[model samples]
Target: MPKVTEAYRRKKQLEIAHAAKKVFETKGYTDTSMNDIMLEANIARGTLYSYFDSIEQVFLEVLAIVDNHSFTFIEEVCNMKFVDQLNTLIYKEVVDLLRQPSLVQARAEYFFSLEDTTFFEQRHKRVIEGITNFLQQGVESGEFAPQKDVRSIAHFMLSFVDGLMLNTSQLGETSNFVYDQLEVFHSSLYYLLGVEN
Candidate 1:
């Protein structure tokens, strides 16, 4: 009985957090209030408090949700044929931005208001490490071109996706051109990698 009660409470808490996320996205951080979140969640003020200590904490949870989803997609791509895996990873990252990806906006607001975080270091290391290991395998198998500087290429490849997102932000809807650009980037990577044409 107690176990069921706790499970129900947790489910209710996630629902409240999801509602607050929608409100925060539309309202903007400075413009949003705890009352607004409570109203959005359709929960009593005390019920809201039972889930989150503060509005900022709720915002962090939303960003964490976006980060986690993106990483899960990334993990799924990591095991494919080298070229397919790389292309999928790059294409998915761009598609995220093209869809007005949540993490990009959340990150901007966070940096404008908050302190540096260990989350940044750990998440970045995990992403780069996975890509590096896959590329290293391709080189060993003679399936991809051997680069004298595997680490450098890994860094640049990661930067390329980030750079595309940054550029997409500046260009807005006009950035639809990035889909074509990404294809060219992938094709060049394949050719340079000495993968079968």
Candidate 2:
């Protein structure tokens, strides 16, 4: 048998992950099975099992890929003006949620289905930390004058955005509800940051 190089293994794993992502997006976490992923990847059951022990493991890989992509945006926008960075981040998030409603559904379903929320909690902690650091930079630069602790503000901001996405996913976008709420959210942020709109 030919030795499987590490690079080849990694490439195959990513291919399976990408295929599983599509299955999750279409069927959500609860409905997706190993067979679904196998069919999506066009691989035999043994091949799928070689890379992942279970569906949850594959989903975790997909989430890791997503988290990496998200942080890449943060790095890319690090040099932008403080307000511009925040605006761009929030706009991109909202736009992505709108464009991939199924992705939102899949994520929500997966997290909700988990008996232990440690993974979700840890992920949120990292996101809040990133946001806090970004906000702290604005504070240090005299661009933002947050009335409350930056960490607290960051937590609230994350919660608000998560809630907004959940609601939009469940209730459906109607009468420009997302834009209306987004406008309100932006106004609230300006007030909280003591920045002129």
Candidate 3:
């Protein structure tokens, strides 16, 4: 038998995580099990256990994959103007939520099922920090002059977006509802950033 290389291990892990993502998206967090993941990945029980100890661990890996993709997207748009970058990010997020409502449901269910929300809280904090840094960059470059503290604005923006996503997921998009809300959000964002629209 050949020894598994580190690269091989990583590739297998990603394959498994992607498979688990599909299962979670379909069945949600509460209903998904390790057996489901194993079947989805088409791996033996022992093979799956060797890579992941629990369903939560597999879910975390899936989240990591998503975060990596998001970071890569952010890096790709780093050179764009701050306003354009913001618009692109918002558009991508909205489209993703609308297109993958099951993913949104899974994520919400996973977080709600957690007994200790420290992980979710930490992730949320990091997101707010990232947004704050982006807002600060805009200010430093003379593109924005926020009416409030950058961090506060970042937190508020994140909260508002979260609420919008949840509402859109539950209520379903009807009669251009999402676009109308997004238009309002964009207008409010510009006002908060003290930028002319």
- Best model per TM-score: 3
Candidate 3 off by > 4 Å: none
Per-residue C-alpha lDDT of model 3 across residues 26-140, encoded as one tens digit per residue = 8988899999999999999999999999998999999888777766776788899998887887777656757673567778998998899999999888788778988999999
**Candidate 2 regions off by >4 Å?**
none
Candidates ranked by TM-score: 3, 2, 1
Candidate scoring better on lDDT of 1 and 3: 3
Give the per-residue lDDT digits (tens) of candidate 2, residues 18-71.
Answer: 999999988988899999999999999999999999999999999888778877
lDDT for model 3 comes to 0.85
| Candidate 1 worst ten-residue window by lDDT | 101-110
For residues 65-177, write the lDDT of model 1, one tens digit per residue. 66676667756765677667666766776576556634445455655665666766676676688667777888886778843466666676778776676567657645448
Give stretches of model 1 more than 4 Å off: 1-10, 77-79, 133-142, 146-151, 191-197
lDDT of each: 0.70, 0.86, 0.85
| lDDT-based ranking | 2, 3, 1
